[model samples]
Target: MAFEGGERGTTDERLTARLRTGVGERLGTSDEHDTLVGVLFCLPNLVAFSIFLLGPVLYAFYISFHEWNILANEGTWIGIQNYVAVLQPAPWANDWAPLTDPTANTFWYSLKTTVVYAIGTVPLQIYGGLAVALMLDKRVRGKKVYRAAFFMPMMLSGAASAVMWRWFLAADGIINSLLPSFLEHNWAGDPGTALMGVMLMAVWGGIGGNMIFFLAGLQNIPEELYEAARIDGATGWHRFRHVTWPNLGNTNFFVIVMAIISAFQVFGIALVFSQGGPYYATTTTVLLVYQRAFEEGAMGYGAAMAFLLFCLIFAFSYYQYKNRDQAEVGY
Candidate 1:
């Protein structure tokens, strides 16, 4: 009986070794198989990005050096003439002051308008979002409803939002009705108020999205930190200053960068709301690009401007990313 038991134990040990060997063989090949699967999964997205985004960007760069006629679907090599035309003053200009003689340089005028729009909208959007986020973060009745209401505007398409705002700011619209007779004016028509009208629409439509971002940042703050602050006899303001704000550094950086980029590329609101305006007051760089490219059939020149705009955006984004430590919160 002892001899039989020893033989059975040896057989079981052999089976276990075989099982281990099988598992090892399967594990050795699994990594390569998983990598192949991952590549297959990502293949479609890579192809789509190449075709839709990367392809056009490269093509635009090529077109920028040529005199491309959109109607003819052809181009003639012009070297840097398109860029020179965009930068040089108009033939009729008496001086080189682009800012003072904005009309003498279409690119400068549009760039100034774009900068003004950015200045007008970026801060208000960021702070207003933070404020709304704070208010909604509190324990209050109907918080979800308020959140939905605020976020609803963000879900609207840019064209839809522009159309809606255009009506609201019309001569006989709701906004005008609220004002006294003498104070009321054509918000989208008058040159003085046209850009302001666009800015107002931009801020209103933008705040809700920014608020959502701020709310997410606010919620991510650890509760333990707040409790600790309170235990240390910290007031609400003190807690926010030292704990809350510091912890929200990453969120703040993201919000600020996105806001600046969005401001620089603003097009739909200015296009649909003011139509780039009364006396070109709202003619932003992007709008000018569109007008030059399609409307006026200066495709190459427009491509040059578009490439410059891309470079400008890249420079700004790079600067912010390089200075990220300045915005970081040390915990």
Candidate 2:
């Protein structure tokens, strides 16, 4: 009986060894094979990225250093002349004041507008989204319906939303009609209010998407933390300050970063709303890039502006990423 048991044990061990060897061979359990598989899986995305994004970016960079003729489909090498032209103040300006100088460089004016737009819209989008998200996160009736309604604006294309807002802010449109006669004015057509009108549209359209992001982050936070805070007799505001706000650090960081980037890149609404009108009051950097590249046919100058914009965005994003530890929440 002992001999039989020993034989059976030997057979079982041999079977297990064979099975392991067979599986390993079938799976190609080698470092080189695994790397090859990973490469294959990534090939499609790499190809698309190269063709669609990398190629154009390289071409634009090449164009930025030249006098590019769109009609000729060629360029004359100028070696940063385009960048200089974009950066240099106007020859007529007596002082370095781009903001107040009537003859200041268009690039500077456009850059200022872009900065103003970012400042005006980014904070509103962040805080408004957070406020709405907090309200929606509660145990309220029709929560899903309200969430869907809030997010509906985000589903519309930028151009479409801009067109709708243009009508809404027109001289005789719904906004003016609702306002008191003294307060009512031509929102989009007036120089003083054109950019503000565009900002209003941007904030309205943007808050919903940011709200969704904040909502997702709120849902991901563990409930036990809240329960513990409640057990400690923490008030609603205290619980939010101690638990919710801290936990939402990453979400806040992400929302702020994206909001700033979007604000800097604002074009479609400004373009469609006022066409950068009322004496270029709403001419953002990107809109100016378009006017230079397509309308005025200064492709190289436009490319230089675009390159600068890219650098600015990269610098900001990099700074945020480098300081990401500050934005992260610890349990």
Candidate 3:
């Protein structure tokens, strides 16, 4: 009986030791198991974004508060001087002679121009696109051909399309040639017409793309909704009012957001056609940034302009999103 009891004690000790060893083995490898998977999952993307997108964005912000040629001059940190130079609402601030010196007023003018561009172009794109989309939503004859024609400008590269538009708006070009000699004027070289020309071109470039999105949204509205509306004596306009507009909430939101963003960063077309020309009549904030940094080699100041534009766009986008979300919730 005593030997049996001693044997039982040894057995219990051995079982406990084995259990501890097993648990310890798992615990030792547990960190490796978790960490290995994490590294494997996130390693590639983390490195890529840090090197490419995130790195440049961070670097741009750092460059914003400095005075430097940046690349060749090795920037000096002037702190908020750059911001002050940009946000001041003084009349004499736009003296762009000191290309390196971005005054608060010059920045304000650029901001004003950007706001005007956004206000003008976004509504044109959104409303015009929606109208075109409504026109094209039916089973009309040769609809595909009409759709392709409308979308052609959007399909072309911005530089190429802008060049085409510039030529068309130039004196003695297609637009003026079609008109009588009395009406002929160099649209791209006249301050009165240059900005308007650019805005028209922008609507042409953007409306089709917005229309495509709206078309998709229209198609997504369940046909049964329209059928139900018609049964309730909701004829043509009424059907559209009850079934179409309300159903288009999401599409309208997308188009407005995209249009505003595109309008704010409208640089490529400006570069190709206007170059902010006709005596700075068409110079946008982004174009001004390019002129400062790359053209004038005031890289630090140019980076500052870019940062300011980014902040404006961020604020605008946030406002639009919040407003749209509230509207949808109200619906």
Candidate 4:
């Protein structure tokens, strides 16, 4: 019996070794070799991310603490002066507030412009997108063609779209031709109308893409809810309020967050519309950053301003996320 047990133990040991070899052969690697192969596969993407994305982000933050001269490719250590200069509402404070004084800082003024631009455009995009999407959700004639027409502008490159809109909004363009003589002021030139023109372009250009998203969300909502609401004598608006709107919470949240982020990062419109102004009226944060970093060669200040804009976007997004989650939980 003892001799038989010893032979069985040896056989079992041989079987375990064979299984290990079989696995290694099938995978073309041992366990340690497999780990090395996995790492090798990931290495290229890691290297590219570090080089193209991560490196620049970290470098920007580092440069934000210094005085950077892109022309000289040099950065002097300036501590937090760039941040202070960008963030401080008043460059010189005391008895007189810059708000009422003529010597108000351009940085603060541009920041306020950016805030207003964001506030104006985001809601327009959200509500306009929803309205169009709801209309399109019904079985309308020429649905595909209409959808394509609306979405075409979103597919165009920013420069191309801006150029197209510039022509349309030109002094003697189609829009002016269609409008009455008294109403046809220089849309992109007058400070009073420049920002409004850009905002209108932004809303029109953005709505189609957002509408598609909302359309998808609307389709995903169960039809039974609408049917049940109808059975209970709910009116069109009542059905929409209780069923459609509630079901669209997630979609609304996504659209709102993206809209806010895009609005805050507006540069192309401001650049092409008024070139950041008919007296700096349409200058956005991104346009200001571009002017500072590239045109003015104040890289540090631009980086600081860019970072501040990022913070504002992040905070708003966080607030939206928290509220969305709470609403979902309550529901």
Candidate lDDT scores, in order, read 0.87, 0.88, 0.80, 0.83
Off by over 4 Å in 3: 1-47, 90-104, 326-331
User: Highest lDDT among the candidates is held by which one?
Assistant: 2
**What would the per-residue lDDT of candidate 1 be over residues 26-145, giving only the tens digit for each residue?**
777455776898999999999999999999999999999999988788899999999999978743464546654457787888888899899999999999999999999999899999
- Between prediction 1 and prediction 2, the one with superior TM-score is 2
Per residue, candidate 4 scores C-alpha lDDT tens digits across 19-86 of 99898998788878978989999999999999999999889999899899897888999998998888
What are the candidates' C-alpha RMSDs?
10.0, 8.5, 13.1, 10.2
Q: Model 1's lDDT to the true fold?
A: 0.87
Ten-residue stretch with the least lDDT total in model 1: 91-100
RMSD of 1: 10.0
Models 1 onward score TM values of: 0.86, 0.88, 0.80, 0.81
Question: What lDDT does model 3 reach?
Answer: 0.80
lDDT-wise, the better of 2 and 3 is 2
Model 3 quality (TM-score): 0.80
Name model 2 segments beyond 4 Å from true: 1-26, 90-94, 326-331
Clashing pairs in 2: none
- In model 4, residue pairs whose N, Cα or C atoms come closer than 3 Å (at least 3 residues apart or on different chains), thus clashing, are none
Displacement of residue 316 (Cα, Å) in model 3 is 1.5
